[model samples]
Target chain A: MVTNEDAARLITAIKTSSTYDFTDYSDKSFCRRIEKILLDNNMDLNQLIHKIGKDKDFLEQMVKDITVNTTELFRNPEMWQTLRYHILPKFKKNRSIFIWHAGCSSGQEIYSMLILLNELGMFDQAKVFATDINTDMLEAAKAGQYKYRFNLGYLDNFDKVIKENPFNFEDKVDVPYEKYFDIDKVKDTIQMKPFLREKAVFRKHDLVKDGNVFYSKFDLIFCRNVIIYFNNKLQSRVIDMFNSSLNRDGYLILGSHESILGASANNFERSKGFYKKKQM
Target chain B: MNDYKAIMIGGSAGSFQVVSRIIAALPANYPLPILMCLHRLKHIRSGFVEALSIKSKLPIIEPHDKEPLKAGRIYLAPANYHMYIELGNRFSLSTEDVVNHSRPSIDLSFFSASYNFKKKLVGIILSGANKDGALGLKSVTDNGGLTIVQDPKECQVPTMTTASMNATKVDYVFSTKQIIDFLLKLA
Candidate 1:
């Protein structure tokens, strides 16, 4: 239903006014999301573009909606298992570890990583950079308040992964639900304790338009389950960015369903669920 | 009954009870592969397979990538991946993006079923919070496939089933229990 003309107009309007560039994303996916956006707002293509050109907040929301931010803490247990067993142990030898949980939605996965590091005794040595395009989600991540019910699953997953690890395993790291949360009697909320709060620095970063925010390199990056929304071209570009962002032997973890196929596959080696940086 | 050797059901939000009842009523010897495309939060470990496994006589498994489709088994889409059926009885998985804000989107599975199985496909839209399966049900019907929808009055979240009922001329609209009974008869 999206004609070439509609695509061109939308691209041009976004490029001229907005900070993000979605021109290179897959046309089919972009158009589909755009149509849904229009429907949601009850606007036709021209009307939507007119609002996008004039309203910054509207444009920001559109970008967030279009980017596909559905993610979970410890999504695909196998990938987390891979990270704990094969990847993090290698990083233990480093002086300090820098991890970018890119496109981290609501910081659940970042917290999951922090929990993993805490269990491994790497919490003191690791600094996590959690970024997403959604400012609201980033703010929620900063607040670190979540419903107790949601945390229960991640806690269980973390416990299972840590206790089951074959190398340098420990059964003593008891991350009971009560340890990480303070039960608030007034509002019935579970506020995350200060210890889990200190590890992550949350920021708003758009993968498509904003240039790399990091001045230096990272030891590990988790960009899970985000690229499939992109067209092949955008996926490659993001992969290239991830490759460039990492130090030598740095790790890039993707979604379980995703692959570093075609051009990107040559840039890294599959090390468990992570793609370890190879010599360029 | 012709080309579709399987049926794929997709729903979200208010789908759990509906899906459970539907699967529960199917006969033990049902011959079609019933693929589920329920939307689950990416973090929660899904017990959908186990939840339905005990209720149904058929085998239920979380489908793996490239797992070949076998008749009479039920495959639930793993959380965070879009489950698609291929032409040669193979399954393809995609993390490509969320359609209708869902990864294991009902629309994606239904549309894929429409294209891949055409007239042989039987797409069902059940109780859900969103309009995901409406267009997809239309696609299936347009492609000469049979389409069924849960009656809106009987659904926990009727918006989605209502949308499908309004959007397309579905073959049948029944209560979840009746729909399951019908599937058993068809099988």
Candidate 2:
């Protein structure tokens, strides 16, 4: 039950004590995350603040815990469907397709993208880059292992996006899960196949502070379900960064419900299910 | 009552028609922003806002993430997301795991609104089958905000109201008509 004042105190402590800056995060959700942290650790605000000030390792863990890492393969099948059928086909002309998954939580999205790209026969030409503020998440993204039973539901989503053609329902492809992942029911693990795992270059990058790490512009940027944690000011700043990082006529695919707003909205034109960078 | 910044309503199950009636009674120029976190089918995203807007004078919207909160508008929690009202009076949507088996969780919404608005908030619990809003309404009470529940006898499903009454010392337990009349007085 951390109050707003208490959350402010913790934020200030983190800012002064570490390089991690949560100042511009959406306060309500951030505060709720802090509350959850305290409850999980069974510690009060004062003790948590003390730990944050003194222990660097503890602070890193806190940052990882605070950043919501919930994601799944083909989480929104409809968005993936649009990407598979409409968006990726446009990039067929490009010799190299550069895809960036900003905030690639637990790597499900990275695998989802790779699976789509591979199915389209564009895997060889695609350069995939993934970045997250949490190093633990980056490591998890690298490992590419998820709980089998926990993610069984998302397998249906994979089938929806990869197998079933919505435009032509009768035209279905029998794509086996073994092609992309090795599901071990005995071990309760769904390990992503090495080909899909190796495609993404996982890196530690902060969306709030870190500007475009890749000097080269991208064909598409996926920053799904990540910007929702940010306040309007921060969202605009990140959106502006995405605008500059994208190549002309490139796409910026946000989460299903996410939309670019404020001044940054001018840079993107809403395409089928994505925000396309307007040719300036 | 005029000093209240926003009104948060939490409902589930047999609460939609009651909510429709209540919002229909609010004026076009209603001074307070109404935040409704009704439990909805996670996949059906579009029609809820349209259905709610049919009889309401104010524009009903499923606010985009980080959209600024405004007066005279009805903000419904988007499907498959938890909506939070931030300290700076802006909407923040989250796709975190669902709470109480609901994505647009009533408890989570009320928790944020209560924290953000503090004593200047008004929280009302309508007819529901679940106990999600009980803890949230209690949060409003704990934060010194006004708390109301639809009179359980008048509710289609009394579990939510009954749970809310047990959760905290609610300020009022009003019937649908009384609740609407009370909100009208605020305007």
DockQ by candidate, in order: 0.14, 0.71
Candidate 2 lDDT tens digits, B1-187? 4499899999998899999999889988899899999988655666888898899999998888877899999998888889988767878888877788888889999998888889999999999999999999999999999999999999999999999999999999999999999999988
Task: For model 2, state the Cα shift of residue A239 in Å.
Answer: 2.0
Specify the highest-lDDT model's number. Answer: 2
The CAPRI classification for model 1 reads as incorrect
Candidate 1: lDDT over CA atoms?
Answer: 0.76
Instruction: Write the residue-wise lDDT of candidate 2 on A131-161 in tens digits.
Output: 9998888899999999998777778888899
Model 2 segments beyond 4 Å from truth?
Answer: B1-3, B24-31, B55-57
TM-score of each: 0.69, 0.92
What's the lDDT for all of these models? Answer: 0.76, 0.89
For A187-278, candidate 1 gives per-residue lDDT tens digits of: 64567678887768878887886656977789898887666555556778888999999988898887775677577879999856568899
Point out the worst 10-residue segment of candidate 1 chain B by lDDT.
B87-96
List of clashing residue pairs for candidate 1: A228-B96, A229-B96, B3-B120, B4-B120
